[model samples]
Target: MQPTELMVCTQHAPPIGGAFVVPAPPLPLVPHALKPEILMEAIALLATAVPLALVVALLCATVVCLAAICRAHRTDVVAVVQALPDLALALLRRRRP
Candidate 1:
């Protein structure tokens, strides 16, 4: 084929390896019966509800972690609390060497 003929053939061919592609149909439009105010209210509710739910979940997680830590160190905490009075008395009774 002449170069001019080859160029004319390719000019009408698909860009990708000559594969034919069908154009996608456009999306359907929303019905006129759907109110914009209802959509906006739903969006607003989601905006506030999502963050509020996240904060509550975070707070619940924090409380669970703290409870676990305290449970794990319960004996150590009790021992320190019980020793406070003796430690104070010992400090008061210490004399210069």
Candidate 2:
């Protein structure tokens, strides 16, 4: 039941090679350490994404410019200004029995 008796029964002896093999402590991993394959994968992803991002940006800008042009040149501005009497006549005709 005592610690001494247990140690004696086990008969602890030196390792086979006369030295205990202990694994060296792993080197601490610094942040953002990129392995070759991981770096390559990131590069590939960026290569694919950059052009797509640029295309989307250009499309958005084109759409915005078109919308601005359409808003600035509404249908009301395209036609000649009608006379007041002609406008009243058109309204009268629209409501007559």
Candidate 3:
């Protein structure tokens, strides 16, 4: 039986002192030159939306923190109880054959 050979190919390095890991060209800059009315409407929309979004996010984060704290306490108790058998086994090991 003959072993199969695998081939790998890579891009040739740029002709220079060392290989060039050139990065992609930067994206073209966009001018945010909005019309006066469009700019005012965007500002108004964000002014109203930002506070509402913050309030909702704060409430959700608070709920998640409370739930996580509750789960942590429950897990701590479960871990202590679960460790009892291992503790007992260790204590009983001295008398084992």
Candidate 4:
């Protein structure tokens, strides 16, 4: 092939010492601030959501603590559960007496 033909075939050959102009990418869309009503809605949502989250967190902590206590006294808890029926009967007998 001729040199010019080879140069034309070479995909990456830069224009002979000529500056290449790359167009700048289009600017991204800028986000506008929330309207006052939307901002207040968000605040009100957060106010309710925060307390609900705290309540759920507290319940979860309570469950975890109770589980830990049960685990720590596994045998005792089982014994008490097993004795509940007898204890109820004994309480009934005592009340009658």
As for lDDT, the candidate ahead, 3 or 4, is 4
Residue pairs clashing, model 4:
none
Q: How well is each residue in 1-97 modelled by candidate 3, as lDDT tens digits?
A: 2222321224433434543434455565754546677789999999999999999999999999778767787878688779999999998997797
The TM-scores of all predictions, comma-separated, are 0.41, 0.44, 0.40, 0.42
Q: Rate the local accuracy (lDDT) of all candidates.
A: 0.72, 0.67, 0.71, 0.73
Clashing residue pairs found in predicted model 1: none
User: What does each candidate score in C-alpha RMSD?
Assistant: 14.4, 18.2, 22.8, 15.8
Candidate 1 accuracy as TM-score: 0.41
Q: Point out the worst 10-residue segment of candidate 2 by lDDT.
A: 1-10
Which of the two candidates, 1 or 3, achieves a greater lDDT against the reference? 1
| C-alpha RMSD between model 1 and the true structure | 14.4
Sort order, TM-score high to low? 2, 4, 1, 3
In terms of lDDT, the best-performing candidate is 4
Q: Model 2, range 1-97, lDDT digits (tens) per residue?
A: 2244223323445444554334455576853447777788999999999999999999999999778667765654444244556888999999998
Q: Please, what are the lDDT tens digits per residue for candidate 4 over residues 1-97?
A: 2244334342454455563334455565753336677788889999999999999999999999798766777798788789999999999999995
Model 1 ranges with Cα > 4 A deviation = 1-33, 73-97
Error of 2 at 19 (Å): 30
lDDT at residue 5 of model 4 (Cα atoms):
37
Question: Cα deviation in Å at residue 56, candidate 2?
Answer: 0.3
